[model samples]
Target: MPEYNAPLRDLRFVLHEVFDAPGLWARLPALAETVDAATADAILEEAAKVTGGLIAPLNRSGDEEGAQWANGAVSTPRGFRQAYATYIEGGWVGLSGNPQYGGMGMPKMLAVQFEEMLYAAGSSFALYSALSSGACLAIDAHASETLKRTYLPPMYEGRWAGSMCLTEAHAGTDLGIIRTRAEPRADGSYAISGSKIFITGGEQDLTENIIHLVLAKLPDAPAGPKGISLFLVPKIKVGADGSLGERNAVSCGSIEHKMGIKASATCVMNFDGAEGYLIGEENKGLAAMFTMMNYERLSIGIQGIGCAEASYQNAVAYARERIQSRAPGGPQARDKAADPIIVHPDVRRMLLTMKAMTEGGRAFASYVGQQLDLSKFSEDPAEKQAAENLVALLTPIAKAFFTDTGLESTVHGQQVFGGHGYIREWGQEQLVRDVRIAQIYEGTNGIQALDLLGRKVVANGGAALRQFTGEIRAFAAADVPHREALLDAVQRLESTTDWLLQRASENPNEVGAASVEFLHLFGYVAYAWLWSRMARVAASKRAEDEAFYDAKQATADFYFRRLLPRILGLEASIRAGSDPLFGLAAEQF
Candidate 1:
């Protein structure tokens, strides 16, 4: 197994140099006094030490042992409890949470990089806290002040973990048909009776109690998604004084045993007459749940970025050290029997593909994070609206595009290992399995593409997408290398957006049929914009750091030259219309 490093230099480059997070933080009065460049750097360095030294060692072992469910309770793999203790002790759970709730109040831009590191180190362990952070964000935003005071502190302290209960056996993506019931009780509280499946960290040994943000239908509610209501239910009841009371009726019926992330407990939770508190207004659960869902979406996107980073690191290590054949350019390794696999053209191609995609993905995720920070923290109303619009447009793309690229990158990483990648000893195969789930969960990539095209772009009349592309256009117009290529990509995205807007009015399937391709095209263009910006920055800094900046430039060149052309194929496919896709009848298959 390869050792996990945090890639601190790349993280810092994106944060301090590329995005100027410290300057942005200084402008936001909420974060002005709390975080600065030095403090952020120190925090990241400490996080690096913890994840790399402690959490990473258990990744393979935890996967090997998996989470055990002997009785109703679930137990995490060995070393996980101790690692989690250290994690909470470091106050890592509430890294970006509200300060009023014992959170550190870090900006999303900074928090996201740490999240990527965490996922890269150990995804199974990371899921436990990822769900907690998202739940806390939802409670802080939509829950009552009394509820927030009661629930937020312990969660931030890591004494209590959290989970989002949205999926059921019958209703995975379509929550309109869910059968969960939230009936009104005599005392004004509600009894939530439901069974939620695919609940991450729903039943765990690391925390004292599990706080679940559940979705159920009320007795007099309307039909479909509108009738649903969000509820806050806990495994152990808590008194008004925040003391733990008797156990609630919630229990884990069973834990899933399949695919990757075996160490993370995906449970079937049964809430039998369990007490739950309503969140937000009644009959508005879907809107309330999106608060957490959107946060989880971006976090899951970072999971993809994390996996890609880990895979690239391991593959490069293997490529440099594994000697298999002589170089095509005669005797490169004169002292050895054969040259290292790094000398081969195909191997280099795979490695570069991994590098370019991973790095481009890292930049793209950070850009989205920066937009989130601007949306949340900025005081100016217009600026906040603009930032929010961009976030709405880009969130789905980030979630889908990053994970899709991540799976592709991991496969390349696995390919680099050849036979060893297929085996269990090297641990490369586990990465392939673990990352596969990211694309499926947090709203599948197909659903994400629909969300991007149907809801964000077309529903909004392309305003949000235009705002995003406008920013890209301005950046491309700046004095940068490959300006023409960047402009062409942006034009392609704009024209494709127009085509979808026109074609969808005649045939609704046009949106669904063209969404994935449109998203990929947009993703390629977005990366092109970032690459051009980075290349300009690297060129200016080439005199200061010769090799580092040059390598950055070379990678940017590769991204533009090799990877950006994929957009052309995507554009062509999207313009081909939906006739071929939906031409078949229901009985044709």
Candidate 2:
């Protein structure tokens, strides 16, 4: 099995050096009293210890053992139970939750890095906490004050875990057709009866109670998504005094046998007359659930980063030790049978590709996290609105782009290991299998692309896009080496956005046809902008850390030279429109 060492140095470079996270935090009055650079650094160090030491050790073992179901209850892999205990004791579940509710209330900027570390160490183990965090966010945002007071503290403290119940046997993404029903009772609670499938942490042995944020249709509700409502259904009911009552009418039907993240309990949950309380306004469940969906989408995107980071680390270690043919120019190790594989040009290319993608993905995720913090904490209305707009425009891109690159990066890492990568013993194959799901879950990357192009861009008439590109244009105006290239990329993206908007109006089919490539093109340009920013920062700090800063410049150059050009092809394909895509009829297949 491969070992994991937290990318602490690079994380510090991104957090402190590039973003000046401490200064940003100081500016947000909400966080100024509680968090500073020193506190953030200290928190990150402790998080690194927990993830690297406790969680990373269980990754391979968890995948092998997986989660098992007996009778109606699910049990995680052996070490997971213990690791979860430690995770709870560390107060990690509430790392970015509301401080009034017994949470640390850390800013997203710092929490995001810790999140990447968690996924890097153990994604399956991380799901248990991840789902809880999303569910808590939804509850904190929309649930009643009584609900928050009773449930938030315990869930944040990790005494009770949480799950999101939206999918059913017949309904997956189309929640409008869901058969789940919630009938109101005289006591103000509702009787919830639904069967939810693919419910992560639905029935686990780790926590005493499981808080389920379920989506169902009310009796008097209208048709379709308009009628859907959210309810707080607990596995074990909670009484008025905040005491645990008898078990509710909820049970796990079975656990899914999936390709990866095997240790996470993905259950088919059956709720038969289960007691539940309404969360937000009736017929507004989808909106309320979005609070969780948005959070989980970003977290799932980071899962891609986590898996890629692990794969890259292992690939690098293997490349340094495995000997092969001599270098093209000359043998580095004269006395050995052959030089290490790292000396090979092809191998170096693969390593560099992985490095560029993973590091760029990290920066991209951090950029989004910063926007989220700004949206949440900034007092100025204009600043807050701008941040919110950017978040809306970029959320879909971050979710889709990160995962797509994440899967690609993992594959590249596996390729560096050759045939050994396909074998189970080396662990590279597992990384590939695990990272694949990130692209498919919490709304598939395809959905994300459509959301970006159709809803976010087209619906807003490109206002958010213009706002984002304006920032990039201003940054490119700075005295950076790649100023011209950066400015050119911004222009290309702006032109492409205009083309998409114009053509989409003429032919609605063009939107779906062009969305995936459009998102990818946008992603490439965004990463280029971020890399340019990092390069500028690195150049200024070259005197302080020569090797690190030099490496940053080299990677930025590699990305600009090799990867950023991908947007060219993407733009071409998008401009071709939907004619070829729709030419093949349904019967053709």
Candidate 3:
């Protein structure tokens, strides 16, 4: 079985040292009463116990046994039900939920760290609760108070789980083309009739009921996306008095046999005139649903980081114990038959690559989490707007870039393991399979890239990009390690952005053609900025904790020396424009 211990030291460094999260929380009136350094640390410690001691052990067995389907009911792998009960009892699902609705009201910074641990423990298991938290966010943001009072408490208390039902067999990315229909009823509710495919946690035995936030269009609604409406459909109906009623018309027809995350129940749901309460206005469901999607997107991106972190831990442990070939320099361990793989330079390279990317991603996720907290809790108008803008600007990168590098990090970790990595016994291969879905779902990384470069960058005339670069420059003004490298990276990203903008003015497809490469460019530069900050903080504190801070400095150096140069190729590709991409005819291929 694979083992995982949460990086509490690194997490603390990012939270307290790198970001001064306690200070920030104190500054925001809403959070000041709730979280302090001691409380946050205590939460992290308990979370590590749950994640490492409880959930991580179940990952392999869960994947092996998978979820079982019989008739319309789906049962998760063994130990999942008990694990989930323990998990929810800890108030984990409601970590960032509102306090009025049976939640703890913790800041998202803690939630982000907690989410990393949860996903690292088990991706399939994490989805069951993560989806509920996300759906709760949407309902809280846009639903009527009546609906909130009736549904939010049970969902937040973990008596019920939540699922997002948006996709149909006929539609994937194009929600505008979905054929699901909603008919208005005599009272206030609506009758939903449709089939939604690939619904995560759609049907599961872990909870008493599954609440579905479904998207469907009305009869006289417009032809496209604007006509779509959001509905709260439950597997089992609930009364106004918050008591359980009979099973609703909704049922899980079947579950998909998947490539990975086998323990997660991905279901095909059929809603045969299921009674669903309308969420928000009739035609504004997309906007409301985005509340959940945005939350889920970030949560999903962390899935990649968590999986890669698990893989990294496994590979590093194996490298130290497994004696294979001799080191190129000499036999470091003459007592053994062969030197441990840790002495090999190639192995070191792979390990360092994983280290740099994973650490950089952790810091970035924390930074984004801080922004989320600020956007929600800050009273100052300017601060709130600034936080909102950063949230919009970085959400796509957080989702796409983190997962992109996450895959790279995981693959490198597997390479460090060599042949054993490919075997299921080592648990490295399962991580690769699990994280692969992070890139495809929650708006495919490609779509996220386009959203970043096209909508957030070009459509805004690069205002948001300029604001972000300005912040990067403000930080680079400090005398930190590799400051010049970071500045050069920011310049390269800006120039590339300008080039894409000008090209897009002439060729519409330029944005689409260069988006993915452009996103990577932005990602590398953003990490450079973050690593610089971490390096600066680590330098002054090296005396306090030599080993930890020294590792931070070393990883920062490796990232600047090796990984940041990746933008050179991405810039060249972005400047190449869309012309070359269109040369091949559709029929010729």
Score every model by TM-score: 0.99, 0.99, 0.99
Residue-wise lDDT of candidate 3 within 1-589, one digit each (tens)?
6899999999999999999999999999999999999999999999999999999999999999999889999999999999989988988888999999888999999999999998988999999999999999999999999999989898899989999999999998999888989999999789999999999999999999899999999999997889889999998899889999999999999999998999999999999999999999988899999999999999998888888788889889989999998989888999999999999888888989888898899999999999999999999999889999999989999998878878887888778888878989888888888889999998999999999988899999999999999998988786878988999999999988888888899989999999999989998999999999999999999999999899999999999999999999998988888999999999988
Instruction: Identify the runs in model 3 with alpha carbons over 4 angstroms from their true place.
Output: none
The residue pairs in collision within model 2 are: none
Question: Can you give the lDDT of residue 118 in candidate 1?
Answer: 94
- At residue 147, give the lDDT of candidate 3: 91
Global fold similarity of model 3 (TM-score):
0.99
CA lDDT scores, all candidates in order: 0.91, 0.92, 0.92
Clashing pairs in 1: none
Candidate 2 on 284-344: residue-level lDDT in tens? 9999999999999999989988899999999999999999999999989998999999999
Model 3: lowest-lDDT 10 consecutive positions: 408-417
User: For residues 417-436, what per-residue lDDT tens digits would candidate 1 score against the true structure?
Assistant: 99999998787888889999
When summed lDDT is taken over every stretch of 10 residues in candidate 1, the lowest stretch is 471-480
